[model samples]
Target: MQRATVERVRVAWTRSTLDDRRAAGRALIRELTAELVPGADLRIEQRCPGCGGPHGRPMLPHAPVLASVAYAGPWAVVAVGSDRDVAALGIDAEQERAAPDLAALFPLTSPPDLRGWTAIEAALKADGRGLLLSPDQVRLSPDGRATVPDGGEFRILPVATAPGLIVTLALRHPDPGPRPTRRP
Candidate 1:
């Protein structure tokens, strides 16, 4: 797969057991690195920073570091960055079957409701901002579009492997063009 452009967003999915899930995630990370940074050897592993839980983030033994990881349930996803750009990416995966309390975890009171909630969480993480805004402050449209609380552009893409998992990527940068003038 080609490297995703700053304006483009991509999501990849694979089915596997818990162990296989982690392996698949690592493989994806390698592939991404190859696509993003050609001729560079990359290796990814899960290590605990004395936190008991496995840390899914990747680390490059050599210099020029860039990568991030997010794993939920039996799925793991990684994003690799470029030299001039910081990698702002997020991934989420969930079981295809309905869980007993999934609704409670992610309440879907109405249609188009669930994607927004998921997008907000993903966007915040992607921008390195977490829980900065309340759930009600952000809104998601019926067509998978999301409006950031502070007028930022956010892109949301649903993961393919799992029905309940949704991944969102948000990019915020200074406006370089001339500002639009409004007439009353």
Candidate 2:
């Protein structure tokens, strides 16, 4: 995992198998629980408590960390951050070329428009507030940034790992500092 700082936020990414992903998710909950409450052992289940949603958004029995999970192809990405911070984190991995129609398999499609839709969904999950925003309410720019409607304060970054898969993460408290410039 690489932990870097864009502004003051600590960002990290890890590539793991399905089993490792589950374990890593558990570890994340444990670490966050330790930080929020001393001497408290938190056991997080990998299932959603709300209407058996396809994306299992786990809720902490007692904690202040907001987390989201997404599974793409064979990889599962889980992001955790402070509840008040509202950092939207998402990740998707796929083969370099096109494969079966994911949309047909799952109700959600991975078209370009899906990027903004995912970002809005992620932002809503991170905010843990009302369900006022819809997939149609957000728009993704050609450069891959998403602008939320209603002047909601958020930062949207869409990541393309391969040719066919896209993951969008939206953070309400995005760091405004200049992004790190990479040299070829």
TM-score to native of every candidate shown: 0.55, 0.53
What lDDT tens digits, residue by residue, belong to model 1 across residues 20-130? Answer: 766777677777667666777676555544453565345665424355555556656555555345445544333334222334443555323444545666665554444
**Could you tell me which 10 consecutive residues in candidate 1 have the lowest summed lDDT?**
1-10
How far residue 166's Cα lies from its native spot in candidate 1, in Å, is 5.1
Any residue pairs clashing in model 1, and if so which? none
What stretches of model 2 exceed 4 Å from their correct place? 4-11, 32-41, 45-50, 53-55, 87-110, 113-137, 141-153, 158-167, 174-184
Q: Candidate 2 at 51: error in angstroms? A: 3.1
Q: Which residue pairs overlap in candidate 2's backbone?
A: none
Stretch of 10 with least lDDT, candidate 2? 2-11
- Per-residue lDDT tens digits for candidate 2, residues 52-170, read 44335555656665555555554544555655554444322333343333343234545433554456566555444324444445555565455556545456665544345555565
CA-lDDT, candidates in order = 0.52, 0.50
